[model samples]
Target chain A: MRLATFRGRDDESHVRRVGLVLGQGDHVRVHPFDAGFDLVELLAESAEWRDSQADVAAAGDGLALDEILLLPPVYPVAMRDFLTFEAHVDGMERGHGSPGVPDAWYDAPVFLFMAPHAVTGPYDDVAMPPDTERLDFELEVAAIVVRDVSDVTPQEARSAIGGYCVMNDWSARDVQGKEMSLKLGPSKGKDFATTIGPWVVTPDELEDCRDADGFLDLKMSVKVNGVEVGTDRSGNMGWSFEQLVSHASRASWVKAGEVLASGTCSTGSLAESWGRNGSLTPPPLQVGDVVEMTIERLGTIRNTVGPREESVAPVAPARRRSRLEASA
Target chain B: MRLATFRGRDDESHVRRVGLVLGQGDHVRVHPFDAGFDLVELLAESAEWRDSQADVAAAGDGLALDEILLLPPVYPVAMRDFLTFEAHVDGMERGHGSPGVPDAWYDAPVFLFMAPHAVTGPYDDVAMPPDTERLDFELEVAAIVVRDVSDVTPQEARSAIGGYCVMNDWSARDVQGKEMSLKLGPSKGKDFATTIGPWVVTPDELEDCRDADGFLDLKMSVKVNGVEVGTDRSGNMGWSFEQLVSHASRASWVKAGEVLASGTCSTGSLAESWGRNGSLTPPPLQVGDVVEMTIERLGTIRNTVGPREESVAPVAPARRRSRLEASA
Candidate 1:
């Protein structure tokens, strides 16, 4: 079953409501739940709750999909994106003149925390950072944690995932490269905005899509301004979603409403594509260009590049002090 | 005025209440506001709200400090820790065998997003990550955003800060060094736990502590297991809290209740101390060790390192697929 968060197009209060999507394509409709039916709260409940909610959804005569504005399905309490695609890692290393992937890559499923406040709706416009010239988009899939757990095994972690959705981890390449050179962060570059949604597809609904090894055999792709940029299969991930989730909870608690994303697939990002082709053939994204990302069974999320705002004032250098001078 | 979040020690409901800290040490008390008064909501209000609340707090006979349990002053909706101390950065580079600080360090106040879920109270016990043998602590000060602002100048951003608190950014150096070698994260290394608070001291209360250049002239220090390991003046930060907040707001929004922290000070961490002395002088933190961080005017926070838990099952390598084989 597909679940979404939305508000009526003309809503003055802008109250978000969880809904169950019905029908398909042009005939799509949404069965809005009661005011207290929060998506995050629902995700935290047992499977019995979902079964009961499906029954309630079947009894309603819903509103047409076009009558409402879709919001991001969940406001993640914490968000972490993992580097789980070996091909993407290898290509990125080669792009920077490295021999191959770092040995550290094979040690564990490494990840970076993302600013949850930067999340936006699937159809929202993404503003380019004023200081960046090379804006890009990453195509990937993200899982929503269903319950709180800690020090859990991969099998236990697998059962804790509530659903999946398409995600676009937007990037400002110039800013990311510079800050990363300091070996500390890619914060400002990736914190400007991240787009997620269309809707969340429950794991149980996709059992048929799982291969013999339990990896999802889903096709993922991204397009810019109607031109296809990259494509790859979801099954290509070096670390499964369960492994990533287990690694995250190794010594810390994984809370309900937290999000863990499968990092960009092979050729799922412009930078990786440029690395493989050895050229910036399509150029970087610009204002007014549309970015569309799709994953099999999870649906699609589309966003347009918005105009860049004026840059903030430059940070002044520290005053030279006797203490600093002495240390230098 | 000092603000805090607390729960009655014997209360089974575990309801958190915003309070005003009153009186001096040993005779201190907390005047709990009505149930409707929330710290986060109050921070987002106009100055008029704060003025009225102060009058209300002055009229109440409050509860003794020992009658309640203190939580982190605020559960920040988002958290960022910035590298603003040049001494710490230089020491870190030297420890890594680098010539000096990266040129990019001078461009902007760089930061990384931190897991808000990992936040613990000032006096809480922090569990060491099971995988780490080289645990460490960082001494710092953190500011809380008082209002929502976007693309604000440093001067404007300064007024948006409501109060300050002491912070301890706990780290697993062994885990951090390995992951940072891949240049994407310091996530799991630092995400297990971060302690902040005693209570938040309002900016108005610290007027006498400001230096001629407007930098806070507060003494900061850290001690482990009763031994003083490091000390520095808060004024030595290369970028002011205002500058860090301004940089954070560039092309993004800084929301009330969010936190921005000054990264480790000079010799604040065991690794940095080891670098300066050319040895592991005090040794890494171990279970049962007490870590105390103090910033003058902001108060002190003490935490005991707890025992580590068992590690989760290891993540397996990706299966060799025909698609990956072809690519290789």
Candidate 2:
């Protein structure tokens, strides 16, 4: 079953797609196509409808795909992304002088949640933040946690996933590279924009996509304009889907429709190969960059990165609290 | 007016401390906290005449202060926390073996949001995640954004803050230290648990807290088993509250009562100071390690860090997608 949220005249409309899910078609599920209802409230109210394949199939298609705008499917109760890739690790390590991480990284997965506004539709224009000049993109797989989970087992992780979508874990290369050096964490570089969807493909239909290695056999690629910059075999990821979910749900809880994204895939971005010289010159996205990314089962997501009209200098530091000194 | 969310049987109950304006009794203006009920709705629907303040006037009164749980004041539509301390930047840079970040470091502030589940009450047990054996606490200030802002000026940033609270930004020291070496942004380290509250002090009441340095004068300290392990002056922060708010709200739309935490204050935690050296050994939180933190105007928050529990390892990573690869 395919589920989506699109924009209509009054508000976002929720709809179901009839054919193979694609970006344009997916947007219609939420908007302009106007299934004539609120998807967020409806999804929360109709638990049985979400579970039944027949009920999902019966939801009408209001219009053809091209005429609509796409919103991130799964207006996630929250979104958590994990660091499960090796290349991204290597690149960051080389930037910092610290010793390398234990190979056990493959043994354990790391995850964090991005803000809800950080969620943008596949074709939406990502704003180049005013404070950042080194913005980059990360290609990854995003899965929606379908149910509430606590202390989940590997098997349970598999079942917890409701569906899958394409994620462009957009990054602030400069800010992230700088702050991550502290061995403390990445707070600024990542929180900006995290993009997902076209459509959410439920697990039942995605089972066949898994390959012999027990990982998905998706072929992933990213391009600037029409030039290919990166490519990778999804099977190269150090950890499996089940492990990420289980690790994320350990002690803590994961809620229904919460989106989890896999960190950078191998060769996920040009900065991994070409843009590492510390120069902010990989490319400034203009109105016509037409940057596009594609994963085998998921359809292509193409967007034109536009420039921000007015950017401001950073404001002065906050007022210092003086009374603490006397108390101390 | 002081606003807060307390844990009730069904959901977090919203309450407005009444005498806060009168400066007389410890009276609290209580109301049902509902996400569905906006501030206007809550104010309009409020019918409860009032609640007594006599129970809360005295400090360390276990009955009133300890029993009433505290959640991050606003159930934010969105949240963004920034890393703006020069001390943290220098320490992280040293760890990475990299040069100082460009003037951009002084020019802009970086931030990420606490997860939706991160909203914790004052007395609730902050779970020590099992993934990383090294858990640490950071004492900082967090304020909620009360206005919708885009390209806001520094002056606007000041006006935008609805209220302030004590923020305990929890960290997985080991995960963060290790991941930063790779130069990847913080994914796992800070995502887990970030606790805020006791209560939110409105911007009007905190007018004098901001000193000439343009930062708060809050004296912050963390004690484990009654021994002082960390201390800092909020005045040491490189970015002021206004700068942080301006940076966070630049392009993104910030909402009313949305919480934003200062990344970490100077010497905020053992992990940032001595965890790498193995000199900072936090006595394991036995069934009764009373961990408490305090900020001048905001108030003190006390929670007993309980004993660690055994847990299973996280599940495998999620299955990859073919469409993702194909699109790439």
Candidate 3:
């Protein structure tokens, strides 16, 4: 079963409804739910999310999905995106004179916090920040935390996942390099906007696709306009969701409704390709370009790149150097 | 005028109310306000927050300030803490082999986001995470963003501050040093909890104290069990709140109700003093210890260090190296 957030196109206010998405694209139906705004709360407060599956699935009382605007499934309490693929890590950092993935990456997953106010939905138009000359996209999968968890081993961490969704960890390469140098963040460089959705699907829904390594055997691909630019198998990650969740929970409490996102799949971002020696780069995403990614069972998430409003300007270098440049 | 968030003793729920605090210490009168949660909203939507100040000041309906449980003045939409004091930077990093004060601290202000969930009231218990062996406190002043800011000049940024609050940027030295080694965070090391309050004072209230440096000349002090350990003038910060906010607003929008925190004042924390040779290290905070910080104009924010619940345990090293240890 798929869960989604939607609001009638005519609604002037931001009141959105959580609902069950049933049927295929043209036949899609949405059954408005009373689960409040938090999906993790819905899943944790009662077993109905799992036990009343058939009741929510009965679509007679639902509205057509096309008549509503989709919002992010939930604006998370805390959101984290982990870097676990060795190739993506090596591909982005190797040319810069840094050693490939640190021994630590293999030991346990590492992730970073994301901006809370910048969440966008699958279909939203993401405006390219003026400072970012290299606007890029990262194809990823995200898991939503179902309950409070801490000090849980990989086995126990398994119960932490409520669902998975298509994610676009949109990035700005130039700004990212500058901020990462400051040794603190991929701050405003990454804080602009991150998109996730189509809808969130429970892990049980993909049980039939599990591979020997305990990851779903799913084909993931990214496209610029209509051409495929990157592809990978969802099962290829060096880290598993369970391990990532377990690692994150070891220190602080991983609260319910928090998001644990898989970092870019190998070759998932244009910056990696640009850093790949001798590779021909796609002209950086321009206004009006459509970017889309799809995973076998996870569904597709599509977005349009748009120009930031004229009033939005890059802070002048005269005022502040990326913390790294200043330190040097 | 001072604004605060509090809940009545009779309520079993966390039904906090925004209010005005009038008078001093024992004579303090609290007039519960209905102006909604976001102080920025209260300041931005109308001039009444400033213009009608006299009417609200009349003592007709109010409760004793001591009768209510005070919470963090506002739980902001986004929180940013800046590394503005060169001394604090030098003090925290010099021993780690990091060259003191990255030139960037002098050039432009840099800040990192804090977890929204971990914010607590001025007087709340700060549970020391078991993983943090050297828990420390940073005495800083925080500004609440009053309006949406993007690409604004430093002068405009000045108008963006809604009020000021005393901030305690609690840190875990072992965890922070480890994470910074990997070049990403200040995350889990700082994600635990940050204390702010007693109450927030609008800039209008501090007109008499504005210093030559543009910051209020507030004397800030920190104490453990009633013994003063550190003190500094908040005005000594090398970077002003205006510069920090302007620098932050340069690339992306700084939303209303977001927090812009000053990095610790010089010698504001135990760790900084520990780095100062011959200063006996204050034992790292343990459960039951009381830590308090008082700022001249902003009043005092006192908190007890509490033990994380027994069930709350740090993830085992077998799972993930504290990002710091591996990098070293």
Q: Write the per-residue lDDT of candidate 2 for residues A184-252, one digit (tens) a residue.
A: 345556666778876767666667877665566578888888888778756667666766777766666
Query: Which regions of candidate 2 fall more than 4 Å away from where they truly are?
Result: A8-62, A87-104, A127-135, A182-192, A275-286, A317-328, B7-72, B75-79, B85-105, B131-133, B185-192, B272-278, B281-287, B315-328
Better of 1 and 3 by lDDT: 1
* lDDT score, candidate 1, position A22: 79
Q: Compose the digit string of candidate 1's lDDT tens values, residues A49-98.
A: 87698679768878886789899999888889988888888888998889
Give me candidate 3's TM-score against the actual structure: 0.83
- What TM-score fits each model? 0.94, 0.79, 0.83
Q: What's the i-RMS for candidate 2 in angstroms?
A: 4.7
- Scoring each candidate complex against the real one, what DockQ results? 0.58, 0.28, 0.23
The C-alpha RMSD of each candidate to the native structure, in angstroms, is 2.6, 6.2, 5.5
Please say which candidate is ahead in lDDT: 1 or 2.
Answer: 1
What tens digits encode model 2's per-residue C-alpha lDDT throughout B40-123?
Answer: 222222223211332232222222333444555555555566766666555545444556434445645656556556556666
The true-versus-predicted C-alpha distance at residue B285 of model 1, in Å, is 0.9
